[model samples]
Target: MSTSPRSTTWRTRAAVAVATLMAALLTPAAAHAAPEESTPVYSYADAIREAVWVDTGLDDDGDGRPDRVAVDIVRPSEPAQQGQRIPVIMDASPYYSCCGRGNESQLKTYDAAGDVVQMPLFYDNYFVPRGYAFVGVDLAGTNRSDGCVDVGGRSDIQSAKAVIDWLNGRARAYTTRTGTSTVQADWTNGATGMIGKSWDGTIANGVAATGVEGLKTIVPISAISSWYDYYFAQGAPLYDSGPDRLSDAVESSGARAKCAAVQRKLVDGAPRTGDRTPLWTERDYVKDAAKVQASVFLTHGMQDLNVRTKNFGQWWDALAENGVARKIWLSQTGHVDPFDFRRGTWVDTLHRWFDHELLGYDNGIDTEPMADIERHPDQWETSSTWPPSDTRTTTLHPARGDRPGVGTLGLTPGTGTESFTDDPRLSETDWAARIDTSTPAKAGFVTAPLTRDLRLSGSSQVTVTATPTTRTAHLSTVLVDLGPDTVRNYADSAEGISTLTNRTCWGESTAGDSACYLATRAKTTGVTATVFSRGWADLGTYASPDKGVPLTPGTAYTLTVDLAATDHVVPAGHRLALIIAGTDKNLIDPPADTPTLTLDLARTSADLPLVGGAPALTRATTGSAATAPSFTPLDSVSAPGPAPRIPRG
Candidate 1:
């Protein structure tokens, strides 16, 4: 349900004052105002009034410059009581305008008797009274602003900064009009944070990297970290041949349609391919990690089919490398799971970060490390640092003669190989199924049952020694829990609907950080959580089974598949199943003709590192049927080896 906007402004003002005073007296300003409402407050709606763009400027050709940028600002109403300089959050989009390539009718479509047109600022009504002033601007050259859209570049960033400065100036002027003690427009003495999702998230990051003095923090949800990878992965455009790509372009154009003249001229030049371009390389958060310094709370869905999960890890890496110590939350879900207004937990967290950074409130946020990772069934773990120390290492070996139920620890070497065909037609949507029905045609691996509750978190690596006939073979790994004869996935509804979603145990990007599969969500299956899954690459066709014989049939080549880090607490008695099939059931699409491949029947073994000092599970226990056992953060686990190598350029 949409939370009813705060009913009264004075009530909100009073609460803010009381809370601010208490915080001033007892705690550091970094503290967050508790959600527990102390009094009725003003709804943000009551604070800002409807206004229209009465001016115009540049709406034109190929040049990127705002002619007469017009913005709609919403501020607290008149009859001001105590001094209150509001913190503002801004948004700007050009979804409706038609002047140059634009049409008057197209650009000026009004709704409900035309009292108010559905302009760019139409959606920011939710940020009011929550202690923020909202601004929505039509990018210059479009609607009311002046200039062509530059997507993610210097123009967008600088223009946003200019508008922010403009807002701060207007806010100061208003304070003078009211005779308040608010400081003249300067920095975040009054505090400011940027909020938005997707496009907005991207802009917010851009703004942060701009190093705007007044900007305090940012809450970018479901944002793109790298346009290059998002549009094109590994130097290849993902949307080039897919129908969804065309559909997305059409949908994206809807916003630009507001400015017909500008849309007609600029749409053609918009980026389409994934090849490295000046714009994409410059716009990448990973490439420009050092530029961002603001406190950020980044969120992403584990199975977001639209944007690659690599964006999240890349952003996290950027922030970590810059030493920003930002907070990250990776849910086991999709694009907009937590975007609902009524579901204010995300907002609540954002507010806390702002309070800590902008307000200097020490409400325990300082104690919170750079990361607040929530992996599963309602459990949140804190890490003083990311990629927590002491990550457990285990292995799964293929089934061989005389060792039907044993793991990979003590398997003998036998010469053999497993091969499957690659069918490109049938592929799984990242969020649709657990198994890639297509890739399984040639992909294969092994799984096992848990001897005890398993808590796999952070980064996982699979090293395989296999010889491929082809120059490049696509190897994939999947971790699953086999229930009896059926395969049960550890993923959840919140993580996503896909058969397998990428998981990040340590602060790393599975999609781009390494060549492996990462589980999207954390799991803690009960006594039934026995079967655990893992696998290796799907050597593409052109190799022995797919094409030419790259490997000598009897040669011993090892292939490794790395699974993403998981935070699962699988129950005892559940058998971990290692399936070594040439195909995956739900992830990658399988190739049409699978070759008959064989694995060495004799030499297969799992070598799990059993820490000498750390005790292993002596007995098995089951969690209650009512509640699944959650894997708690091991606050003090011994480090398994020297810290894993941090990725480098």
Candidate 2:
């Protein structure tokens, strides 16, 4: 075994080369690493192909730098029978491909955060292993992507198309290895669907508009369709004041970042609109509703205070107008909370929908009944169409003065005026923000309490002429049912049935489109309320006050308070109390310097569409009873943490 020094050196170099070659072969490749490849890396019941980022040279908007696109393919681990490829469910999300913050954090519902958190891709993250490939793609301008953010505009549209094309190719590559045929060249050939919530939900609508070659079906859960209602309700900014923040608050990269990127694009080759024009039409979903062709399964929450419940209504209306076959599921609960992901039923429902449409499977999604939760009944109702055709109106009147213990019935006809001075110095706490305002109520008009259990459920409305001292003032009116004993002292009222206390449940606010008429001749707030059936009852005939002593013709009943609505059942044995005022500092958040309101009751009266036969007023037998609902601080109803996964990417 003896050897020369030169021979020994040669042997050492040969050994070193062998070692380096082995190390290179052992290092994991950057391409999506299979779950079982390294140290038994996390295997989410579903097969997952780790995301990989790629560069696209198109500046998209001449932003100098090339935009980067990234995608992750998740497939079922089990082999398919014969030659069937797994169907593809392509979902686009905004996440950092490198940092993994967007992918690993929350899947985007309303959470207490300072930026937008998208959770759609991760929602049911393991669902892909159930024989479908889930593709999560990043748009051109977001994390690792190199194009200017065009919001829901052209850039986003182009990226969506490109992603779809890429997924088609990826699925072909995937099928070759997995022995599946679920994904075909044509999305509609076998099965391919889109799923998302909120902004991600909106993407389905946008892509459908482009007539994308193969977007079979869409499950748009809790998505926003009307920018007007989502941003400004009837020209008024929505009061998104609750602690459960919105997507924009958390997702926006601060206002400064947005301004910088947008400005840079405008200066560089992008078209510049000096003033308001139709240039932003692409970002407006409502205008493009007619172009959406895919069948959609829409879900929304009536009690969704953040995005305004009207968005769902608007979408439903637009889809119908466009002759699109769409189904909706409205709930009284908050956004995405109803899915109950623990049970895995929600995923099944979505899967069934895609299977029926994309795979041409007889999953019977189309034949399945539509479902919704009626607020008051505290039950789910299934129907073939939305907003059940059986919906009817029951109006409760505001009878005052004639009734004794029912308070100096100021809502009586011929009453002169009821005035209240608002002091912003004291300030009002609306939802959570403390802001200065001249008055506490500003969204809707109100009436005196009805001397009975007034059910104010299912699309309630009120009209009043408001003479604001300033240009505008928010008006909120609450119609309360002052039950038996007209006036009784009670307390401890919680949501749900039979959860009672000393105080009786008496009032409900006009939730969605309540209105107010300004004396200044300006278009007042639109008044239309879609009260969830869970809490308040529909308004019906009420007992008029006894016709005892007559009041002076011109005397005024000055009743004052704010009005709002909720999704909780009010118990029986409760008097109907309607307190109308200029501001609802508790439920609604408005800007400071709120205007002062002056309403003359002499000029206000109800255009009630009465339900039951007009009932007669009975004289109080012996003793008189009346318990007015006094002002009590409101209890907050918002939850915080990671957003539940309902297509919020």
Candidate 3:
């Protein structure tokens, strides 16, 4: 109390210095106590293989007993026998007994003794010899698990969570589904990491959002965070019976009657109305992102039309807002795994990541860049953050001349109007077919050739003030690159990979599980115009997705549609085009009646997140119309059809 302020400050600094010195001295000792990496610490031939059933305490099948998730584990025999506690790398999946995993459709192979002889992919073969336990759990109601498939619901998530609990000595497990023998994970250190792709990866995301203990990190590749967004977008139903069809596809039980009730619940819950309700909220991981305690490594394809880029875009933003540590790989391929895209680099990076997170290795991975974006095929660029963290949103208004259906994009407000009639039979390609001509089905607008290259890094927002001739109408907005170019045609391959006769190997291979896979190549397509991004919305749901307010005929209303996010570079001499049309027949249901839409040219504009370009308008009055080039219709090269079906694996 008698000490002066200056003297107190000096004392505090001295105390901090002493504590810092002590920590520095102790850190070296702690680092020395950590395990060292050596070649073949465990023998692959001597790895232990066994199975256990973890109790989730949920009777989703109504058998009066808790659901038991079947887990097949392979670990280092010598270390486990010597009482060494090792970390776990777990992959909980529903495809073990169904369509299988990877391009080869590799399923889990078992010996006559019911012990797992093979695990799909190289996770078990590559990691077990390096001193880690690899466990593959059959998700509830799939494979050997005892329950009904809930399709990312509570039962599905709990089944995986229970295994983590058992590893941490917080839950019960048995040698069999009804066996009296207790099975314990006494050899595990209780630090777990989950990884997978598609539905398998979706389970990892769901469990991580629960904030469960003992989970160190998760790698969700091409995963879904919200089922609602996956099937519907702003009241525009992408597909009918989406959930029901998915549940039916994954359930291995031939007896459909066994889970008829659950199937009915899924159908009733979805409703195909594009509205958020309690059912969707329960399945949305973004709503509970703040509860996540584990770090995340996300991977997705920007050209993935099946799951779409919005899934990763929205989830990544939510994780950032919650202050969660995250890393991402945004690729150009469609729904393809990184292993096939960048084999050598992917394996090396993944190995270091697992070591740092699960084994507590002091690697500098966390200090590296947070995002890797494939600017072009096989050309990747790493950045400190996604969207470049310096992207600017620039709005371009529609400027019209004497043309009735054609317009130009510029900074100045326009005076004329453009109109289009909703056509139910019109596909995305159909709209592009009329880009050079005046058509009633679509209104086309283009910008002058860019003087310099422009890079678009995120989603684009299209705001239109229009009046519908009918009470309700469907609107589709597309951002197109108007120039001749060659790009990957993801629409051809279901998984975005074409299997080649040539085979290449990655990682180590075993007799039971081969690390070699059929080589893959993207299907290349040449076209005069390529759609960079697209969006759809139901006009009636402009105000609220839950309820629709029918618009009065001739009453102007403003609607904003968020286009899918993408990472693309528009080279010089290329023009940007905005095509406004009716329903996209390839993706969604069309309106009941065709409606004519009158667009107010002055109020309609598009906000694009662009980088490395000056904000200048290309007005029709400034002699910029000469810079716009005419192109052959896109349909001349390829016609649009139904959206590509998602690959089973």
Candidate 4:
């Protein structure tokens, strides 16, 4: 059964009125009346629907005229019925007519009149009634849009920016794909907010980085900050092939033929050599973060191997440094939308966010906590900032243990050395399950069971001084929680949330479209160990992530592997461990040749972000370099090809 909308708490509206009165009391001359939306006060049943092709200055496909971006819109009849213009919410995506969007993979369906009958997700159904216009845009070279796909290049970014430009009356739009006459977005008040998940969200980051006018805010979920990092890490490629695969996937059949040249450019300029090229740099939004003027509400799954947590970590840092007002939600799921795992709260909070940013409502959302981190499955906590600003780095070293292959992690420097031969065949699951066993593939180190619950709040770094027998080698460092626990089954195709038969409606419905969507619950399973964070690098590029310096087979190199940002708690009686290995066959693409690496224990250390810092770690210190029960060999565990839980990168 489809759910129906009920009265919302509208938590921030009362605060908005209070703040407005205070502002008026403080500055009587400067204060003006801002619209206060108390509820879904408008009617979605009579919402106006239309489509337009906005003009982008770029001729990416090499056609004579400028490329046009297709935009499908659904807006409450404020301008038509009430004679009032409203703000806009846009999701410019390549997935609109391709892979689809949201948990149900909802696609746009048009009526015989060529107008959109249903827009994917609940944005339109929910927001339109709240006095906001929603537009679903087809990215350049995809769907009904003009020009060829350039992936995340100038063409792609420009297509979306052009829509914002049109909404703000800075660019042109037409009623049809190749229409000569222009159409104006006169009904919009020009304040625009962009939001999406995955590639769609990635475009939000790119567009916001451009600092384009009229873009008031963005909500990017599981988005990418840099194309280079998406495919490679520290001069090591994450996968084979090039960006053309993604570019071709989204383009329509007719457009694919026209986009052949653009696809070729993507292939030719790909970061296949593991070196950041002009192509990758052009798509690097982090470098331009300082120019961002839009407030951001970002979300990412801690276990998303697809886009990776590093993307949000880096982008968030940049936005913070540049003083871009921002809020974040970090979940334990993998590449899943917050709507799936946190439906009701997601809609409520998001409603407040859009009201504050685009609607210019004086909601106290900005005064609230900046980060909402899900430390465990369905367990959420708020902080003033991510990873807690007071977190301190704790350095731990690896030393020989009582067991043959196992080692201990301690507060003091280690005196001995350890060696591990490269094994690209084994996956992370195998390496983690076999930590205590004697193996040439990896070197494992574990700490004693913690006396108190210790939390790792942010990105950790593993510095390794190793002499490899082979000139070309790959290094991978993984941080693991060594204890039995039940966690969201991110390995599942659903990315931790199982869609339920029951439906929940967010807004009004019509004969053709309803705001009802299948509800979801966290899909969890039991596991003895969990890989929380991991980082990789090519030994040849040990000196720098960008440039490769040739390595001598016999010489040692001090390389640092920066793990993805994470928030995890190792409860009392549980343990934490570090594993250094060669290729992670399941996650990273293996190098042609992997050599045995000999590590100088005294020169290697792992820098952990601990909320409790040094004194907190005192109780958890290894009394002696002895084998821990948690480090026992996992010979019984099996690592099948492509370990589950690696999704939504």
The lDDT for every candidate, in the order shown, is: 0.41, 0.39, 0.77, 0.81
Candidate 3 — what's its lDDT?
0.77
For TM-score, the strongest prediction is 4
- lDDT of predicted model 4: 0.81
Q: How close is every model to the real structure, measured as TM-score?
A: 0.59, 0.57, 0.90, 0.92
Q: What's model 2's lDDT at 324?
A: 63
lDDT of 3 by residue, 593-641 (tens): 7899999888898988876323532222234347457677773335444
- Per-residue CA lDDT of model 1 for 207-303, tens digit only, reads 7877666666677776777665455333223333332222223222433444454343333433432234455556666666666655677776544
Comparison by TM-score, 2 against 3, better one? 3
Candidate with more favorable, higher TM-score: 2 or 4 = 4
Q: Where does model 3 exceed 4 Å of error?
A: 1-40, 494-496, 612-625, 635-641, 644-647
> Any runs in candidate 2 off by more than 4 Å, and if so which?
1-61, 64-68, 77-82, 95-126, 165-191, 209-211, 239-281, 340-344, 374-384, 393-462, 476-592, 600-649
Clashing residue pairs in candidate 3, if any? none
Q: How well is each residue in 1-649 modelled by candidate 4, as lDDT tens digits?
A: 0111110112233355346434532356545544444368787888889989899988777778888888999988855564556789999888778778888788889998789997998898888888789999998888888888777889889989999999899999999888898899888768899999988899999999999998988999999999888888887777665688877777888678777788877888875668777889999999999888888899999988778888988898787677677789999888899998898999999998888776556656776887888866888998877768678899989888776447888688887789988888887777888877878899998888776788888788999999988778889899988878788877676668888999999988888888899988988877788888889988888877777666788899999988998888887776788999889886777776769889988999999999878777776653533446644433332342353221232
1 versus 2: better TM-score goes to:
1
> Which residue runs of candidate 4 sit more than 4 Å off their true CA positions?
1-38, 622-627, 630-649
Worst 10 residues of 2 by lDDT: 534-543
